[model samples]
Target: MKKIILLSFLAIICSTTGCKKFLDKVPSSFVAPENYFNNEKEVNTALNGVYDILSREQTFGGQLPIRHAVSTDESFFSYASFPTGPFYYNFGADDATIRDLWRYLYDGIERANVLLANLDKANMDEGKKSVVKGETLFLRAFYYFILVQNWGGVPLKLTPTTSINNVNIPRNSVKEVYDQILKDMVEAEGLVKKISDIGFGGRVSKSAVRGILARVCLNMAGYPLNDVAKFKDAATWAAKVNEYGEHALNPDYSQVFINLCKDQYDIKESIFEAELYGSNSDAFREGGRIGNENGVKCSASTDLIPTVGFAYGFVSTTRKLYTSYEYNATDASKRDLRRDWAIATYTLNASGVKANIAATNIYARNCAKWRREYEVVTPKNKNYTSTNFQILRYADVLLMLAEAENEVNNGPNATAVNALNEVRRRGYGKLLAGATNPANADYPGAISLSKAAFLKVIQDERARELCFEGLRKSDLIRWGIFVNTMQATATEFTTYAAMTTTIYKNARDAAQRVTATHLLYPIPILEMSLNKAMVQNEGY
Candidate 1:
């Protein structure tokens, strides 16, 4: 379906933007917007174009999911020796990766604007049209949310940019951008289809909008904005999803990701994901590096591709993440199942056998959540795997609700504790819908913890459950502890790392480089040059 849409989009692009028809008078000229978007097909094509940006390499396709989100306490670049890069955080605004991410996100916004601006011209079923409009609005707001979260305040471009000359827009305040996001997303919730109606997690659904809205509110309630009122709003939105009665945690914790690797949608658990397809063994080049870049290390020359697809294994888990999962210091039976699944315990060797990583070397394990071994698309490309990267999940929604509820009520109410316990029960592999697991109690004595201690539990729970799914850095930033956390991580590396190991120096250096300035990425140098009213982020 994605391939067909993308191919159609390419055809439309060619027809409208100067692909030649040799028999025509103006063979390679432009087709004005007035002539296009006269039918539902045309408008749908344009909408798919906007959705395409979400899977671009600069966005969820790779950098944002891996490099941009890692280097935090959860994980780090396996090859961190590079002194300056997104992973190292020692780059300037002129850095190409930063500029590319900024451009891609804005490109998504612009595409959404173009579709929405011209949507009314199409003669389609009004209901279908409204859903399309709702999707576009949600996407535009989401693009802005990413911008605001990363750069603090960015130029809010709403209307379509019809010309190249209009480039000097002023930046909006963070509050203003967030307000616009809430307004658009709230309206979108009313217009978009429900997850059950959609039958998949790839496209925008009411639950997706509400879940992300809750996330946005949670962000506002923290860090720079510090809008405590938003906590209630966040809880309200999350409760809507929880109470929707359709979604639930997939019984097996690891199977949740395994389903993603196999391109199967468990809409019950995965609320939304970037639809990644095709291995590029054919003409469709839309696949992503979700598993390949972050999968267990496998060499093309040594490991047989047919047995275990090649993965550069560029990203690895931190000791902090390995230790974050609940486990008794001496007993193995008290272990959390999420730890081994989240962090690989073995790597494939030259003969394609499992080379188990020693228990002592926790930091050496790769992120195992998105393993490529289960990828069903055969003849897989070494650089790309057809693994759909989940953006929102029911477990995450539960955690968000618990966090926000705790904040709003000044303690963990029954609802909050139960919501949190659902996730904890799943982690211990004891959550069967109606069955009792007397052997593994839910949180043991969670109810007795004070508000402060419960908040700490929520924080650790999020890391243990959702590490390397690309929320850790933003999570730390919102908690107003990114710098302190990274600095402490550096101390840990200094304390635990062998003095002679390269990881000791590199990991410590990367962590130490983080400072107040890293709270938000810089406004791209290209944007600064074009928009005279734009200001660079502090210390950039």
Candidate 2:
């Protein structure tokens, strides 16, 4: 995966993040598909264009992770000014953010379609060519997966868009869209390389494909499409990753995220992540607001900026996430260590020093998972830092298997219990990657519990382990408890928690605004106006 330079428009433009802009434009000097991809080099260039979408502001780079994904039970937008935005659950079809997200996803799919349609034109080795084709197919399926989950059913375009005149297409059913996704991913499983061969988390690997396949199956088993049979398939795919024995959880829970911040690849723990590098200081605009938007709040003093970097800390942790971890009354080591690291207990002062936050002030703490102070890039930009964001990891795979196996068996078996307990052991600092465990943190009580009771454990454990990683809102929605969870959190903020007037209003209003319509965003106004076949989501 050559990630530094993303070339698009058939190699006519070469920029660190050029394909995002190229998608919206018809280059005056057009390079036809037949004119390019005459060699392996050109074929690889087209594949880079497909991967570039993951770095765009509309996808994993910024908007998806920072703004759209944070407003959940675990966290919320800290500022109170913007009442008509997706973060506050007050946006509509006319919202710019919603429009951009819809367009960029289709743009990524189009890139993949062109590459897949023209891959064999290049004179390349059969082995290498197959890998590229597999990657492109997986990416196309992944883009449609995002669309189907967010908008219920979007226009499905499989072939390349040859003309601007033939753009109006009808929406596919949710089941039809998911079937295509599974079809592509199941084929990709046999063609992609192993994580051990890649030795990095940026590119798609056999493990990544399997892990994400499990996730897609779990989504189908829940929510609007209650295909209960997919639970067995989900468990099967997740078990394949664990059976491979190539990935494991890094003993320390915080190090899994810190490895991402430092641009270090721990393939054993991190299965796949978005590659972000080089703040514009070096003339490459590839960096994103992963650290700046969700990190600890900092004053932009020249003295403090040099060491600690700058962050708006717009996303704040909620009391629900704070209390999810086990707390020991007197002993600190006996407690789960994830709470303090995921939720910031301190802020950086102007003097580049750590100022401890008071214990009573829980709601004001920032999302501390991706702290900018640990970024290794020199002269970091205030608005963007070179911090890569994790999309899939080994811990998530374990949890998915546990959840699926529970549903399939009507209760948790030993394999399911052990898979989940492995993550818990590391969260308690009882298990290291290779060292022998001195004490086991396995839940002895969970073994005898009913299926309903054990599902609750999986839910709380996911919030405790994977918080602020951009998966909470979707997880809540898939479980069919998103609206209830938001309404419950809103009541908790107003009735029980100690909060200031403005914080109470902002937090309560955002949660209470969620309705049945919010499960999926409405069709963007621009899209509806342009595509005659499009219909708006209900209650929008």
Candidate 3:
């Protein structure tokens, strides 16, 4: 669907811009806007081009696999080869992944610009027009946000067309990118509507936009980059979500990832997520909407076993993170069932494997959070895994709100508990459907908290609730303990084993510990090669 639309965009864009069919699909020529927006289908096809860019792996599918994996200790990485697994796994910036990420995200920006610039000219149903326009704006902001966060200051291009007359540009400051992000969010918030729009599986919704706004503000509130003044604003955005009352916590943590993973558009806890689709009913795969077919891939997760990091066996877990769990053996044996969800941290089938079955061989603490949708088909389809990428979840919103409230109200207020406990209640199979803050136990005005003390709880709560969702690295960074915590973890984790019952090997080492260069990702080589105006990030 997206590929067909992209070709249309190329054909039309080339015809109008006098671009020779450099890629064959787009003819070198120029066609005026008047000719392009002749009808709704044409307008929609153009809009779909914006969606197509997102389907590129750099934006979601491919890049996610890198950012989510490299930024943490989910696996042991090797950095020996100049630009292969060894290079990237070692946090080296000159790798293909980094370069590809740069090209892909910018490609997304270009696609968005083309769609947005001509959207207003399209004569489509008002509702459909608004939805498409709103989604493009939201997605543009999203791709830029990824660039800003990962690449720091980046070239901020909101409009389309890069003719010889308009090619010169410079990297915008991070603050500028952020300001643009907020602007896009505000616009999107007004435009987004129903969660279930026709074929809008991954389209931005009002809740999703608001959710990202809240996250943007929350990230601004933490330390070195303390936009402390935004804490109140953050609370306000989160409160709007709470007041709107459309989403709520999922009762079971496991359910959040499994059965209910799809249709996460307006999930109570889901803020933003990347969408993946298996093209054919064969369930193998076409190509992802994210265009992941572009390159060589690495192990899906950091090693999960306690053995050798790259052996594709054990996915090691740090002992410190494992022991953080508080067990209550006296009561219902399922104390801290959330621990089970952290696949690399606990034993699932601890009993001796029954001798006759394959079940016994299934011993590893690695993340079981995957799917085997395809048995055969494309080569990549065979290695294809069913783990959907999640960007923002509501629990993070509640916790962020709790932190913001604790800051604004100056302590763990009843409101903070209401937000915090709402998430936990779901964990315990409880719902806040009709319950009010302060519960029945405490008076609202009487509760409060000290900033210092409150921050500690908020940090712990983030870890307890969002352990392996790829926020660990950033959370520690936000809290100012990223280096200390990660290094200590690697030390204690050196001898750690992924499974208790299975005897494993190879994971004994002190290879890729957190370092100074890790503060930011390096600029991709392709960006430098393609965009002469681009600059490499520090220490690449």
Candidate 4:
């Protein structure tokens, strides 16, 4: 229940002053489990190390979200020459980003393993010990989930790697890995505290465990697994979180993000997020990246300057996403309020003047979710803003419940319809009284639909609501439309290229690059080389 000072704790865990290569399996000499985890303070310190990895530039801090956004129809890099080859689906075994992502995830898993293996030795209170155990289990399951989703069956390391011999463990089957994830989450559900008791969304809680279980079950129900019965399980788990009643949608969609920038954790909406803090200098001194990667490009100091200035144009919303915003059929004046807040139509020039992007410039739109201007305290450096990266939210729970309910029942039921409408009501800025004027009336109420029709509507609604939040590609993959969607986007790019020479010619080429094999990333070249037992994914 206490606020952990992450920076100071990171200093304790990473005190050993050696820079090892990213994939090197050498253990740090200073904080080895034999020397650390001897006391309650030490065990808590080790847990901080697990949380620290989530802030790394290669993982949640930047690359992971950027990769997910650009690889899908939700976004793309602005410049033709931007080094986004992997995101374009053009990279192979030697891609450094993919390799870094693999290493970072495994590194976190290693920390969690060490903590779990030695927690019993620490002289902590029994209640606190259970909380720590639950958190570590959740963290380990989370890392494995990301690995299984991206790389398929990876080496499942359940224990601490005490020596070099244990490092070369072979990859496990996808089902085996998922089985462990589900097992860990189910155990975590009972051990962790409720969200209200924890008072912050950053820590793992009962609601967080249920929320992740719902997500994993949904994945099991779709795509390669096609375990249709899991749809009922997914809906049941998501509904449990709703029934808990500790989380709900924030009235103004924009304020949710504004609150995040100001370090006001919204337990009612943001269920879980990777906590980030300090200025750019703080990140540099502490060996961490400050904020998320998505933002507008700006020249001078403005409210958007701190967060958006560091944005390298590596990812921006696509035209497909821009046009997905729905409007009230009866009242032409009303439109989805999420459109402008999620995507920037204009940017500030060098002199701090607003400049409209040309209509033909398809790549100019930037994600506005990480605005720095809303921070109560100005950032010390442009690169580091204290905006936490939202991982799970209550809106997602409602939508997932709706989708799974439809899939299980073969039509939209009363429960599914109400859940779906609650999200829509908030999106139209009508959930909170006085949040919107009469001009923005309640979202033309929910409609009745069959299974097929409702599923299509939910897919489009997710795109409109959660675009640029790093979940788009996986959503498409689960729906069995990833390849088809990419091919269709490529066709659209080809037409845009004909109309304007500024657009990257290869944009169309890359859009068509996704194949069945491209669905999972190939084993990183370093991993394959280091562990001969590790086999590469199909198609290079």
Give per-residue CA lDDT, model 4, range 1-540, as digits (tens): 115446555444433223332223435554556667777888887888888777777777777777644667777655566544567788888888887888788888877887898899888798999999999999999999999999888888888665555445678988899889999999998899999998998888888888889999999888878889889999989999956679889988988888877778889998887876655465333222322356665565556454444444456776788777865658644767888788876776756566888866655677877665565544435555556777889889999998999898898887787777778778877776855463344334344677898898789878877877788888988899999999888877776545354444556666788888878998988678767678889899
Off by over 4 Å in 4: 7-26, 283-292, 301-310, 328-333, 358-363, 377-380, 435-447, 497-504
Task: Name model 1 segments beyond 4 Å from true.
Answer: 1-5, 8-29, 300-303, 328-333, 432-439
lDDT of 2 by residue, 1-540 (tens): 124465434335222223322123332245667677788888888888888788776789888887888889988888766667888898888898887888778778877887888888789999999999888889889988988888998777887765555546778889999999999999888898998898887888999999999999999999989899999999999999856689888989889878778888898999987777777465446788887888888766775575678888888888888987887869645678888888898888777677899988888799998988788887777788778888899999999999999999999998789888988888888765454543456776776778888888999889999988889998999999999999998987887555566756787888998999899998887667767777788987
TM-score of each: 0.94, 0.95, 0.75, 0.91
Q: lDDT of each model, Cα atoms only?
A: 0.82, 0.82, 0.53, 0.75
- Residue 93's lDDT within candidate 2 is 89
Ranking according to lDDT, highest score first: 2, 1, 4, 3
Tens-digit lDDT track for model 1 on 117-225? 8888799998999999999999999989998988898777787655545556777999999999999999999999999988899899999999999999999999989
Any idea what lDDT model 3 has? 0.53
lDDT of 3 by residue, 1-540 (tens): 211223344435433222221111112346655467656787766665555555455545544543334334333322222323321334455565665665556656666776677777777788878877888888889878767766678888876654544443678887788889889888988888744332233557776787778777776676336778878888888777655666667766766665322323335555455655443324323233221121111133323211111112123333444455444668432245565455433222212111231322222334433222111222233233223456667788888888788888777777787777666555443442553332322222324546677677667667667754556666666567766665664554444544232222222233234565565677655445445666777677
What would you estimate as the lDDT of candidate 2? 0.82
Number of the top TM-score candidate? 2
What is the C-alpha RMSD, rounded to one decimal, of candidate 1?
4.1
- By summed lDDT, which 10 consecutive residues of candidate 1 come out lowest? 18-27
Sum up the clashes in candidate 3: 38
lDDT-wise, the better of 1 and 3 is: 1
Q: Native-vs-model 4 lDDT?
A: 0.75
